[model samples]
Target: MKLLAGAMLSAILLYLVLLLIPGYPPVGEIPFYRDAGFSVIAHRGGRGLVPGNTIEAAENAVDIGSDIVEIDVHMTTDNVLVVRHDAVIDTTTNGSGAIANMELSDIQAYDAGFHEIDYPEASWEIPLTVPSLDSLFTALPNHRYLIELKPTTLPPADALCELILEHQLQNQVVVGSFHSSVLQYFRRSCPSIPTSLGKSEITLFVLLERIKLGHLFNSPGYSIQVPIKYKGFNILTPEFIILAHNLNMRVDVWTINDPKEMKVVSNWGVDGVITDRPDIAISLRERLSFL
Candidate 1:
C-alpha cells in the first residue's frame, strides 16, 4: 500500500512539473514535422456504421462519399503494420492480447468485428478481419487515408514508411500521432507525407491562438487536428481557423457527428472534419450550399 501511494505521489509531481514548463516542451518541438484535405475524414473508417479499421469499414467510407478515410495502425510481433484502433485486441476482436505481442497470422485469425456484431446499427455482411496496411492501400487506391499512429504505442515508423513508399502512397495518405516522437521519426523517414500537430504542439498552438499572437504560429506539423472541445474548452473557433489558413495550414476537428455542430464548424471555415458518420457530414455539406 505504501509503495502504491509513493508511485501516485511521484506521478502527481511529474504532472505538476510538466505544467510548470514553459516555451514549448521538447515533445512539442518538431522542426521538420512540417506539412491535406478540405473535406470529411471518416473516423476509424466510419466506426459508427461499420466495424472500425477493417477493410469493409474503409470501403464503406469511400462508398459513403467521405473525401478521406481515417484508420489506426499498429505494429504486430512480426513487425507488420495492421489496422486496429485499441492497443489490445480484446475490445475489438474475438482474440485477446496486445497487438505488439500477437504475430500477423495470429491477428489475422481473430475476428475484428466481434464487438460490433451485436450492434443493430452495424453492418455484418462484411466478414471482418484485421487488415494489413498494404491491403488497404491496394484496396482503396482512389481514396486518401488519414493514418493515425495511435498514442497507445509507437508503431514501427520505418516499416510504415517502407510500405508507404512501396505502395507509392506518399501523396495519397496523411499521418498523425499524438506522440511527438512518432511523428518526428516518421517525418524524418518520409518527409513527403504530411503529419498533424502532436498533442503538445496542439496545446502550444491553442495557447498562442487564445492570446492573439498570430505571428507566433510555428506549428511543427503541416496541419492541426483537434477536438471541438478539449476537456470542456471549445478550441475550434473562427480565429483559430483563420490563423491556420493564414499559415498555409489546415484545421480538422475529429469525431464530430452532430449535424448542428457540423454546420457550425463548416460555417466557421474549418478545412475538414473527422467524423464517425461520414454519411451525415456529407449530407450536411450538401445542404449548406445554395443550389
Candidate 2:
C-alpha cells in the first residue's frame, strides 16, 4: 500500500510540474472576433419587446442598439431556411405544423407576429409572417447575426452555408446548434464562418475547466454561448471567462434579462450578453461606459 501510494504521489507531482511549466499554443483569432467587445446580443431579436424571431423584432433590436441580432433557423420542406425557435410552429405562429414538413409558402401563410402577450387583441389583419433567411440578409445587410440552427432530420447546414456564401456574410455571422453533429457538418461545409460551441463541446469544456485541464482543451468554436447557470450550477464565473480568453475563445452568456445579472456578468468581463431585452442591455452598456 505504501509503495502504491508513493507511485501515485510521484505521478501527481509530475503532472503538476508539466501543467505548470509547459506552454500551449494560443488559438488563432477568427474573423468574427475581430475588434469585438462587450456585445449586446438580442436573443430572438429582442423577444421580450416584440414577437420573437420576426423581422420586426430584429429591426427593433438593431434600432435599440444591439450589437448582434440573434435568431434561430429551421429548414422548410422545400429547403428554404426560415427564422423560428422551435422545430414546430405550434406555439409561436397562428397556424400549426412541423417546419421541416411544410413548404416555405405554406409556413408563411401563418402569422408569426401574433403574440398574445404583445397584442392582447391579436388580429389576423396584422399579419407578420415568417421571414426567409435570404430576406433577412437583404433587409439587414450591415448588421451582425448569431444564428442557432434547430435540430432536424432535414439537413440545413449545406443550404445555410450556400446562403451565407451567396450573401458574402462570412464575417457577419456566427452559426451555432445544440447538436454537435449539426455544428460539425456546418464547420466542415462552411469553413469560413465562425461558430459557437455546441452542447457536447460546452460540457467537455466545463469538465476540463473543473479538472484544471482547460489549457489542454482544443476548442473548435470561436465562442461559447451559455446560460448563467445550468441545472443550478453557476457556469459564468470570472475564472471561466478567463479560461476561455486564455484559449482565445469568446464567452457569451445567454438569455440574461435582469439588470443586476447583466451588470454582474459585464463586470466579470464577458465578451457578450445574449438577452431578450436589448433595450436594457444597451442602457446598461451606456451606464458602464462612463464609469
Candidate 3:
C-alpha cells in the first residue's frame, strides 16, 4: 500500500510540473512579443533623428518602425491648415514671422531645414516648404497620425473636423490640443475621432474634470504631458492609473525620454507613451518584450 501511494504522488507532481512549464517558460526563452500591440509614437516625427514636423522627419520615423507619426498643425493666413510646431516660424524655420500672419505662398519661402543643424547626418538644406495638412495626409496614407492643433487664429475646429471627416480619416487619427477649449470644440464637433486632453498639470480635481468632460464629449483618452513628479502631490498617481483603467479611459503620457522611466511607466500599464526617441523606446520594448 505504501509503494502504491508513493507512485501516485510522483504522478501528481509530474502533472503539476507540466502545467507550470507551459505557463512560465524557462529563462532565455523567446516568447512571442509581437502579439502585444503597444504603440510607439514619434513625438514631432522623432526630433532626435531629423528636423521636427517635416515630411522627411515623418518618413524617417516610419522607417524606424514607429507605429505613429505625431505632427503639429497651424493655419496659414488664408486659413489653410499646415503642419508645423510653433505659432511662429522664427525658431523652426529661416522665416521670421508668425504662421498665422503668413500666406501659404509666404510660408513656402522659408527654409525649415536651415536650422536643423543638430542632425548633421540628415543633410537637410534651406528652402523647406511648409506642407499642407492635405499633402501630409496624401503622402502617408498608411501611417497613423497624432495631430496636435496649435493655438492659432485660422481654421476653426469645426472646419478642421469637416476636412478630417471628408478624408474618411476619422478612425485613423488622434487629435489633441493644449487649449482645452479647442479640444472641447473638437470633441463637440467630431465625435467619431478620438480626442486626447492635454494638460500641464494633473490633479485629482483635474482627473475628475477630465473624466467629467470626457464623458460629456465622449473622448476616448486623457493625456497628461507632465512628469511622474506630479504623480502624488498635484497630478494623477499610480492610483490614478488604476482609477483611469477602472473607468475604461486610456492614459497617455508625453515626451518621456528616459528608458528607466519608460520601463516604470510601461509597467504601470498605461495605454501608450509619446517619446522623442522612438528608436530607444523600441529597443527597450524589444529587450524587455514589453510589446
Best candidate per TM-score, number? 2
Which candidate model has the greater TM-score, 1 or 2? 2
TM-score-based ranking: 2, 1, 3
TM-score of each: 0.83, 0.91, 0.75
Candidate 2, residue 288: Cα displacement in angstroms equals: 2.0
**Model 1 CA deviation exceeding 4 Å by range:** 1-37, 117-120, 123-126, 151-155
Model 3 lDDT per residue over 254-281, tens place: 7687788788788877656788888988
Give the range of the ten consecutive residues with the poorest summed lDDT in model 1: 25-34
- Clash number by candidate, in order: 1, 0, 1
* Backbone clash pairs in model 2 (N, Cα, C under 3 Å; residues 3+ apart or in different chains), count: 0
Q: Which candidate do you rate higher for lDDT, 1 or 2? A: 2
Best by lDDT: 2
lDDT of each: 0.78, 0.85, 0.68
Tens digits of per-residue lDDT for model 2, 82-110: 99888888876878899889999999998
Name the weakest run of 10 consecutive residues (lDDT summed) in model 3.
24-33
Provide the lDDT at 65 for model 3: 89
